[model samples]
Structures are given as C-alpha cells and as structure tokens.
Target: MIDETPVLDDHLHLDPDHHRGIDAVRDFARLGGTHLLVVNKPSWHLGVEAESGEDFREVFERTIDIVDEASSELEGRAWPVLGVHPGLVSRLVDDRDFAPEEARDLMQAGIDVAAEYVAAGEALALKSGRPHYEVDDAVWDASNAVMRRAFEHGADLECAVQLHAEASEDMTAVATWAEEAGMPAHKVVKHYASGRLEGPTPSVMCDKERLETAVERGELFLMETDYIDDPDRPGAVLGPKTVPRRVRWLLENGHDEAVRNAHVETPKRVYGIDTEATLDRTE
Candidate 1:
C-alpha cells in the first residue's frame, strides 16, 4: 500500500535533537514517502535563542548539514530548502537590538548563503515570508522587503521560493512582489495554504476539498503536513507520515492522477528535483 505511488513530503524539519536524523527520514519512507524537502526549523524548535544574525546562520548551517546527512544515509531521497525565515528576520531586527536596515542586510546575507548552496546543487529552494497577516505595518513591510530580497536572489539563481505566510492572508500581493522582483508565479509557492487563494502555486494541507479543488483546476500545487517532528508535541502539526497517508486516501478515492501530480510531478517541477533518481534509491 505504501509503494503503489511515489510520495514527496514538500515541507518538514529534520534535526538531530528532535527528529533524530535518519531515524525520522526512515519513518517517512516506511510510510510510503519517497522524498522530502527539509526546511530549517525555527529557534524554538532548536531549543535556542536566535538573538543575532550569527545565531540564525548557525541554525541554517546545521539544517543544511542535517539534510546532507539524511540524503546520504537515504541515498539522495532527502533535499534541502534553505532561507532566512521572515519571523526570524523580524526577531533579529525588532527583538535583537539590530536596526531594521542592519537586519535587512543580514537577511540578504542569509539568502546569499542559501543561494551558494543552491548553485552547488546542495539545496532545492529558498524560503521567506511574513510570520503572520496581523503584524504591525512596520514589521509587515520589513518582512515583505526582506522576502522580496530573497525573491530577487532566487530569480538570479533560477530557484523556487517558498512563502510561509498565513493561510488567510491575501497572497496575490506576494505574487505580485515576486513578479516585480522577476520571479515567475509558478516558482513562488504559498505554504500552509487553505481556502481559495489566487496567485502562486499553493502547497496546502491534506484536506479532501482543498485537494479536490487543486486537482479539479489542474493546478500546479503540492501537499504537505508541515510536520515539525517535535518530541514534546508529538505530531505537533501533523505526523511525519501525514502526506503519504493523504496520498493513500486520495488514491483509494480514485484520484490517482491527482495523487501523482501532487506527490511527484508538482514537487519535481517546482523544486527541480530528480524524482526518478530519488525514487531509485533503496532504503
């Protein structure tokens, strides 16, 4: 049942402390997942205070190393999505005593670092977005500005950019920003999305109606559990196997093509991953 169709979990965190490295990657694989994109977990998930740009950089580097280790252990089944999360940027600026200008520079520096990895084929995509829709105007603007900088870098590298915005926020504006920054709408993914939103391909949670809508529209979107893999909050957002479980459900419901698109084709097109190569790897 787990091997009938290839599955890719587009967003998740894998850390030595929480997710326990290859053990967690094998957990996802055992559930039928063929590939995964490992995003850097926030400071809270790492049990540290990201009070400076250096602290955030450490987190990003650790995340890349974790993904590299997992991919090696899994034989290229795991990939890295690197970036400076907008929430971390806000904290660095607002809470860490760094001026907004300084924080923006640091955020750009982080994107540059991620771009270097992407250029080397070590990472798949770049991520940046507002923490929430309700941040004050100044913070909101700053967040968008930093994300826009990331977009510009992604554009230069021909890499995809994933947005971590609230599901309810209007994402058309973000898409417009990406376009203005020279990134195509298809290269911009709206993460943790729900409801009907126009603009950028959406990477949504596994809900029947949402999945149906995306399939019906022949939309280029992906599905994820956004699984945090935290020990304290077991399956905190969703379990490591959530995406594969959803794929099974979709397949049982006779949406085979949709399942393939969401779990295989979409991820390959958006992240530029070699799905066949990933699928060819043995556990």
Candidate 2:
C-alpha cells in the first residue's frame, strides 16, 4: 500500500511459548512491514540461568526458528539478532550473588556463543549493551567490558550490534569502545533511540514526532517498535504493527525518501542484506 518500500523493524521479540510467535509476524506484515530483526530475549527470560556459553544456544536457536518460520510462512522476512542482554550482569550480581567479575565472565561467554551463531551465518547481527538502570562502579565496569567483547565479535563478523541502552546513557561515549574493538561506530546500532544520535546508528523508536525531526535533519536511522509479544503486557513498549503503521504515516505525509532511507538504505548498510535479496533467498 505504501509503494512497497519494505518497512523493517530494527528491534523485535517473539514469544513462542505463549503461542504468539508467528502470529506477531503476521500482524507486522498485515500492516505493510516486510522484514524485522528478531532479537533473542535474555536467557533468564527463557527460564534458564545460562551456566555456560553453550547455554545461550537455546536462545539463539529459538530465535532462528522464529526467523525460519516467519520466512517460510510468507509472513515477511525475519533475521536473528542474537547476544546476551547486558542486564544479565545485574541479575547475576544481585540475584545470583555472583561477583561482578564472575557476572562479566559469564556474559562474555554468552557473547562468544552468539558470535559463533553469527560466524555460522545463522544470525545477522549481535545485541549488547550495559545495564540501563543504576549500577555501582564494579558492575558498570564489568558490563562495559562485556559490551566491548560483543563489539569485537561484530568487528570480526562484519555485522551490526544492536545496543540496548537509554538515550540518556552511553550514546556518545560508546564510539570509543567500538573503535577499540575494531568495529566502526556506525556498525553499532542504538536501540530505543529518538532524534539525532551522535555516534552509532539510531534505531529510532516508532514515534512520529521524533521521526519527523530525524527526517528533517536527514539523519540515517532505522525504525523499530521494540515489540515484546506478551499477552499480559500487550503493547507495552509497542505493538508489532507499530513500525509499518508509522511508515504509512510517513508516506501519507510525503516523507517517502525518509522511509526508504530508514527501512532499506540503512538496513542494507548495516546488515548487508535487504528485502528483495532476502526474499529471493527464502523463495
């Protein structure tokens, strides 16, 4: 309906355990979305504490299943974005009573597993970031070290790292970490970003006001809903249809070029894949 510009959500999650997995992808396609990066939720969210690096394979494999099913079912295309969520550090420290160093080691091992997925070409990118909440100096330092490990993996794999952090947090300073790890700052995507971000690519949350501002500034960014498909917390961060719906708004308001920039150009640049190519491979 919107001239086939290929709306792609930069961040999304699936809940297969609740029978809402493929259904959520269908919702996105119905609203004109053509693709998404199906990021794996944290390991503990899957009811496992992740005792070892291989433990994360369960999380990545589930996400890969969602991606394969979404593509096979013709519910648009999906790519896996797999990594350890940085929040694991806080949980390991406070809940599991692990030292900050131990928590960091576990998280780095998780990242190693995720990188193996990327190396095998099962995933398109990595997900990583420090805790968005308050943390002490030790926990904070450990998280950054873990995040840098993720960046190093991204550098070797030549894929983007979809970072989860507050806009008020490390948006600007993260460039140095990426550089030290040999990943370009542009290859680091700032998830939940709004407006013009300084270093990494902004995976802008689907907000018309912020979108309009970014478009006016001619910033290169991606659109996402951060959709977490929970029946109880339905539409908490946003619904699956949010990205495509906002894209339609952009088209109707005459921001056609911006739509293409966010959904196609930036994705291709970051992930080295796009709609038609992904479709052809699936077909």
Candidate 3:
C-alpha cells in the first residue's frame, strides 16, 4: 500500500536553543520524513528594546538567512511561507500606545518598520483574550502589504495564514474578509482556541458553514490542534494527540485532497515550479 501519510507539513517551529546555527538545520533536513513549509513570525515586547525592534519582517528574514546559509551548506531540504502573522499586529503597535492620529501617521509612513520587525527573528508572544480580538485597520493594512511582498517575491515560498473563530458573526466577517483578501489558492491552517478538535472553548469554535465556504473557494484549510494542548500551559490538552486526530479526520472526510490541490498544486502552477523539488534544492 502506498504510504497515505501527508508528505508535507504546513507549519512547524524549529527549536531555537538547539538549532542555533545552520549546521543543525542541515542535519535536521537530511533526517526529514516530512517536508516542512515553516511560517516565521517574530516579535519582541513593548517598553523593551528587542536587541532588534519588535516587527515580524526582521525576525523572519533573520531566520531565513540562517536557513539560506544552512541550505547552501546542506542543499534544499526545507522551504518557507513568509508573512507577518496577524496576531502580532497589536503587539507591534502597543509600544507606541499611539494616539489615533499618531497611529495613522505611523501607518502612512510605509510598512517597512513592520517588515523590519519580522526580519528580526523573534517569536510572537500572544496573550489570552476573552472571545475575540479586533484587528486594527492600520495594522491590517500594514500586514497585508507585507503579505503582498511575500506573495510577489515568488521565491521558494507559499503563503500561510491562520484563523480562530469565537463568535459566529465575527467569524462570518473574517471569512468574508479572507475571501476578499486573495485567500484563494493559499495554504491556511485553522487552530481552535483551546487548541483541541473537540470541545473547543467558545473563543475558538468557528461556524462550520463559513469555514466550509472558504475551503470550497479554494483556500487550503487544515485543522491544527497541537497548540491547544501546549505543555507549557497546565491543563491545556483536553484531547489526546489532537493535531494528528484532526488531520486524520479531515483526511477521511475528503477535505485533504481539496486542500492539497489548493495549497500544493495551485501554488506549483502559479510559481511555475514544483515546491517539493525546490525544497529538495534546500541548500
């Protein structure tokens, strides 16, 4: 029987402490059983100088530089889907605690500083909220610009975005906005608020109809639950092996092929190259 296991991973974070250099990434890639399309979103805190500033572009670039140096040493074994994840938008602007006018001025200044934040190579820090968080229009605009750059770069990369739905109405709006914002034919993963498939907290459960609609429109959608059961947080896991279980369920239910087509095939067509082969060029 052909191995039915998914050959690709849409998301993964390498251990920074261990993989301090390219040599480590090279070794990790050579032993790879699954092809990883890693999304890099870096951050620092407010009132704190990050050694680097607190934007995503800088962090992601730094991480990519490491990967590139390693790839040169080892050859291609991994690929990246670069973007400034939405979750950090608030944090990026929080330091300024900007007045509405100042916020507007900063946004008008061109999103390069925001891009610098990503290139700095810091991990995003998130705080738990009650139900949902409203994305400020300014931050959204800046993030979209960064995403556009990543899309246009057309390198050994794909676009990756994630969403969590807590309120039905809000989720509907999110779904609509996502559809409008060129969500079609991009790789996207969904994570529940509590981080599990079943029994998700109110903040995480999304309206199924809306989600299905997004998928039908050609947005690659995969459910990821590993973060739900994060060991760092006591009492996080509500289900056993939630990520694998959700993946298995989605596959058995026929969502896998549909997502694969959008995430993998369509990207190949757009970029005029097979990502797998490109990843094989990893050095």
Candidate 4:
C-alpha cells in the first residue's frame, strides 16, 4: 500500500469494454486510492456507432452496469457520476434527423434519468458541461440549456454537478447558471480544470503545475486522471494511478495537509463520500 493519506480520484471512466473491471479497481486500491467517482463514457467517445437516443440509452445503461459492478467489487469504494456528456449533446444536435428542439429535449431527458438515479441513491453527482472547444452559438445555447436543466434537477436532489468543459471557458458563467438554477456554487465541480481558473465552483485539475498552483492558492479542488481506459489509447489522458501518484508527490514535497484536503476532506464535503469508511472496509 502507499502508506500515506488516502487518495480519491474524483473523476474516472470505467466502462467494461475499455476498463479492466475489478482488476483496475484492485490496482488503484493497492496504490493507495481509497475511493473514486466513476463516470459513464458517452457512446461517441467509445466509438459505439450510435445514431439515436435509443442507441445512446443502451450504451448509457451498459456503462451504469459497469459502474455498479465495480462498486460492488470494491465494496462501496466507488460512487457513480452519471449524466449526458456535452459531446454527446453536440453529436445529437448535429444529426440531421433531429430537430434543434428535439435534441434539447432528448438531452434534458437524459439528465432527468440521471437525476432520478441520484435521487434513488445509485449515483453521487451529475456530469454536464459545454463542448471542450467552442461551438456554434445555437449549439452552445442548447447545450447550456441542457446543463442548466441538470443543475436544476441536481439542486432538487442535493447532488453535486461535475462540469466537463474547456479549461479556457468562463467558469464564472457556469457558476452563475448553476446559481440561477438553484444549485449552490460549491456543488458544481469544474472537471479537468487548470491553474488559470478562478470562480465560485471548485475544480479538479490534472496538470502538475496547475494542481500545485491551485493547492498553493488554497483553492477547493480535487484531482482526476480522466482515465478513458481505451485499449487503443492505453492510459490516455492519464492513468488510473495518476491521483495516488500525485498524492505521493505532494507528500514528498511537504504538502501533506493539502493532499488530505483535496483527496479526503474536499470530496467528502462535496460528494458526501467517506474516505475513512472506505479505507476501513478495504483494510
């Protein structure tokens, strides 16, 4: 074991087709990871050849099964993070068969399903945001509307919302929308954030410099690998061990308390996860 403060990867994708299932979780835990927030990989990202909402739903359900199985294998060490990914929203809008209004409605429906799952205690957070890069104004507006709907539903259910957007995007605007939708700012987490960002919502960063800077600034944030687990791109973005490794880096550099806050305390506060309980179970 890592023999230090417990580590948590706040965001990770763990579909059966790509990820190694229980083996991956075992490896992560061995490396000192206490918990992880497992997100569903959208059909588009997995090259699933999906063309309609039904096709997407099939992929979404499969992903949920993967997450559920992982959680069972890990014995409560993993929590679910489910929602319509913004890229999937863009793809639906771009499909010629779907009218703009229909696409928006479909996206909102996906969020509704995720919210229901969260309310049923099957999930801990909702993942929604705009495209990684800029998009047409109309497409952007529709995606934002879908995200707002997720925020509103998450607020009602008291679940956190994890934002997957471009690092350069205006985080303040996201926080504003969350507030207007009645979700508190602290409940919105900007996924894949960097040092350049500053706003109401806390963020999770992967870049070493950005992670260190945010920690120095005393920013409320978490760490993630965003591990796709794709065999073709093995360890793409970062590996599953990235967060635990980073925790070790921080400890070696004399940032032990920062590591505890980011990997233990912050996640507990935001996602209602109990790292100590997870550790106790694993032990």
Candidate 5:
C-alpha cells in the first residue's frame, strides 16, 4: 500500500441495494484510515424490466433518503455525492416492451412526482426487498432533469457522476452535457468494462491522460475504483496505497506538482473539510 495518507478517496459507492446501513461503511473507512465520498445510484435491475406497475419515483425518493441518513451520520467524516448513471439513462429512453408514448408520458409524470416526493423528505429509495427498473431512456432524461433541479435547490452538496459511454464520441457528448450544465465534467468519473460486468486495466483508454487533459481544461478529475474487473476495459483503480505511488510517478515524470496537488485539494474544498490535513497527520 502507498504509505502516504490520501486527502480523500475520491470515489465510493454505498448503495443500500448492494449493502445495508452505515456501520459497514464506518468500519471500512476507520480500518483503512481513509475518508470517502459515498456515492449513490438509483437502483435499476434487469429483472424488473418486464414488470408492470413499476415506478421510478420511488427509486429517487429512496436514494435521497439513504443519502440524507448517510450525510447526517457521517457528517464531516464522509460526503454524499449523488448521480444518475448514463447506462440507466440510456435504458430509460430506449423503447422497450412498454409503449413508447406511454413510457415517455409516465417518465415525465414521474419527475413531477419525484420533485414533490423530494420536498416531502422522500429523497431516499431504500425500501428493503423491492426491485427497480433497468437502465433506459426515460431514466436518462429523468435523471438529467432531476440533477438540474437538484442544483436549483442549492443543497450545498457536490456529488460525482459516472458515465458509461462506449466510445470517445459518446464520452465527448456526455462531457458536453456536463459542461453545459456547469456540472464537474472532470469530476464526473467514468467506469470502464467490456459491457457492464467486467473490470478495467490501469492503461485503458485515456486513463491518466484524460485526467491530465481535464485538469488542463479546468475540469475536475478524480481517480475512482469500482467492483469487478474487465480485461478489455480500464479502471483508475490505483487503490489507497497506489494513489500516492501514482502521485510520485506524476511528480517524477515532470508533471506540474501544483496541478497534481489540486486533484485532492479541490475535492476537499467542495466537501468542506481538510481531508488532506488528516492524511498529513497519519503520515
């Protein structure tokens, strides 16, 4: 493991659908001696696709509640970053078994309901033993619209987004939308896999180079690690120890130290605490 302490472990997923409660999270962070940015995604399962009477509103409401709980409990220890996965959006918009017109209409209607639900303290979607929709087009538009409204609420929260684009062109398009919306395109991390069930390599497409580019372009970029591995795909999975190793590599390779320093620094600024300082004490 890299002996140096990290200011922040920039990306983490704490979906209740996958895991339960904050205790596991608290124990994980304490044992590792690292602070995390707990990320949450709307749960959309493949099995729920053909089901009738399924609604997306509950997903958003439930997700928000989990976030609220995590934020309240973790407080300065962890920050909650909310985002809609691109794959989910694509699934929502795609014309599946549901009638195109009805799917679209219901999707729009769900958004209105979600807004009200959010106002009513239903921002979380942690209904135990319940299933969710798979990724699609209606989910895409709805998630985008949901994020836009989230910004309007000025909740003083900054969440990370992960995009699962297939190609450079698709990635660029996603980047464009993030840029236009004033969302952190750089901070919006991408997960690499052959499809969605694989893992990524360290040298996959535009990994470190992309971070360098995002930094140069004044966008936010943070290394992230997710589950599963894909030989054809690449993940910035440097891990806790590997993070400082890469930092040393960047510094030795003639990259600007000031720029490298900003990777963790900026996240600290947005998350409202000096994780770097905490890391310093550990060192």
Candidate 6:
C-alpha cells in the first residue's frame, strides 16, 4: 500500500489545543494518508481578537508549527496554508463593533501578513472567501474586497487560494475573478465544494456518492475531508481518515484512474508539488 499513489487531503484543519492534533494525524497516516495541507483555523476559535494584522501572526505561526510537528515524528508530509478568514468581516462589524470599511481594512491587512508567509515559502496557499452564509450588501462588498486581496496575493506568489464561499450558488464569476487577478482558475480552489458551485478545479469532499458524481463528470478534481478537528464535534464535516479510506474504496471498486488523477495528478497541476516524488525520493 505504501508503494501505491499517495493520498492527499487538500484542506484538513488540525486544532491541537482542543482536538488531539498529532494523534489525529497519526490516525490519517495509519490509514494510508501521505500528505495533508494543514489549514489555519479561524482566529476566533483560538480566542484571538485580531484587532490588527499582526494579531493573526500567532495563528499563522501555530499553523506552521502544526506542519513542523507532524513532519518531525511522522512519515506523512504537511504544508501550512495561512490567511484571514472572510467571515472575520462580519464578526468585526456585528460582534466587534467595527465599521464595514474598517473591517475590510483589517481583513485586508491580515491577508497581507498571510501573503508574507506564502512569499517566504513557509505556507503553500492562502484561504479566503466571503462568508458561507448570507450577508447584507455592505458586508458582502467588504468580504469580496478581502477575497480579491487573497486572489491578488495568490497571483503574486503563484500559489493556490482555497475559497470558502457560499456553496449553494454558482461560482462562475469567482473563477473569472481569479483569471482577472492573473491567477489561473485551477489554482483558485473551491474548498468543501458540493457537486455544484465548483471552479475549474473543484476540491470535492471525500464522500462516496459525491465522489462518484465528480468522477463521472470526468474533470480534474481534488478531494478533501474538510476535517474541522474539533474535540466536541469530532468529525462534523468528515472524519480524519476519510480521504485515504475513500481512495481505498475507489481502488477496490475499480476506480484506479480516478485515484491517480485526484490524488496525484490534479494536485500536481494545481500546486506544482509532486506528492509522489516528495514522498518517494526527497529527504
């Protein structure tokens, strides 16, 4: 099984303080997972107020620390993806008493800091998009502004940008925006994507039915668990080892090509990192 194609989770969040981080990753490795793109959890979850951009540094560093921690003691590799979540705009305005414009400025500043990490090659991607839920016009515009900053940064770094926008709506314009920002549509990922609302390269969830649909459609799609890593909820979105387990399902059920494309080729195309090469050759 180790000689088989590497199983990569495109968006897996690990909150060590609350969710037994390394232990959870060990679960993934035990089940044949080889790589994880460890994403930054929202700041509020870490009890961060984030009054300024620098306040986000702690979360970004901790995200990097998670990758470093896993790499030190485990064979499975991981990369940090840092950015200010777009929901921060609504939080700043409603919960924190910040004006819409002020919230926009703050979130933009936060992305600037995350971009520095990407530029330094400490992180592989930036996570940004408007809130998944509905918002008023002012908040929506501000959130779009923040998302644009993320696309702009991703363009400059030539890295991926994982979006967390509304899943029910079409994202045609979103892909156009990525192209407009000079970032390829494939590099602008749709994180936690349903069968619908996907960009050119959809990072589909690790589910049997949805995956079958994605495969039948015959497009280059990636898979992820979207594991929230919350102790209380445990596997709210999906379990820690869902991707590898699903890959096994695909292989045992005669979907070998799907496994290769989703697990190996698609990621190589989007991020330019060869999972198989890294796991097999490089030290």
Q: Which candidate number has the best lDDT?
A: 6
Measured on C-alpha atoms, candidate 3 has an lDDT of: 0.36
Deviation in angstroms for 128 in model 1?
0.6
Candidate 2 C-alpha lDDT tens digits along 112-200: 99999899988999998988888899999999999899999988888899998756533668977898888888889999988688889
Model 3 lDDT-worst window of ten: 122-131
Where is model 5 poorest over a 10-residue stretch in terms of lDDT? 123-132
lDDT, candidate 1, 70-152, per-residue tens: 76544337777888777775676667887666766777666777777778887788888777646666666677787898889
State which candidate, 3 or 6, has the greater TM-score.
6
Estimate, for each residue in 84-160, the C-alpha lDDT of model 4 and write its tens digit: 88887667766656665677777787787777778888778888887878788777788888889988987898889
Per-model clash counts, in order, read 0, 0, 27, 0, 32, 0
lDDT of 1: 0.74
RMSD of each: 2.6, 2.0, 8.8, 2.5, 8.7, 1.8
Which candidate model has the greater lDDT, 1 or 5? 1
Q: For model 6, what is the alpha-carbon lDDT of residue 118?
A: 88
- TM-score (C-alpha) between model 6 and the true structure: 0.95
lDDT of 4: 0.75
Candidate 5 on 149-268: residue-level lDDT in tens? 433332322333333434332344444554565654443444431211111111122246554554354433444444212222334343333333444455556655433343455554
Instruction: Record all residue pairs in model 4 with backbone atoms less than 3 Å apart, i.e. clashing.
Output: none
Error of 1 at 71 (Å): 2.7
TM-score of each: 0.88, 0.95, 0.47, 0.89, 0.48, 0.95
Candidate 6 on 1-283: residue-level lDDT in tens? Answer: 2446788988988885776788878888888888888889999988889989999999999889988887653454788888888888878999989988899999999999999998998998999999989899989999999999999988889999988888753687888898899999889888887644456578899888889988887778889998988877864899877888898888888888888888789888898888877674445
Q: Rate the local accuracy (lDDT) of all candidates.
A: 0.74, 0.84, 0.36, 0.75, 0.40, 0.85
Clashing pairs in 1: none
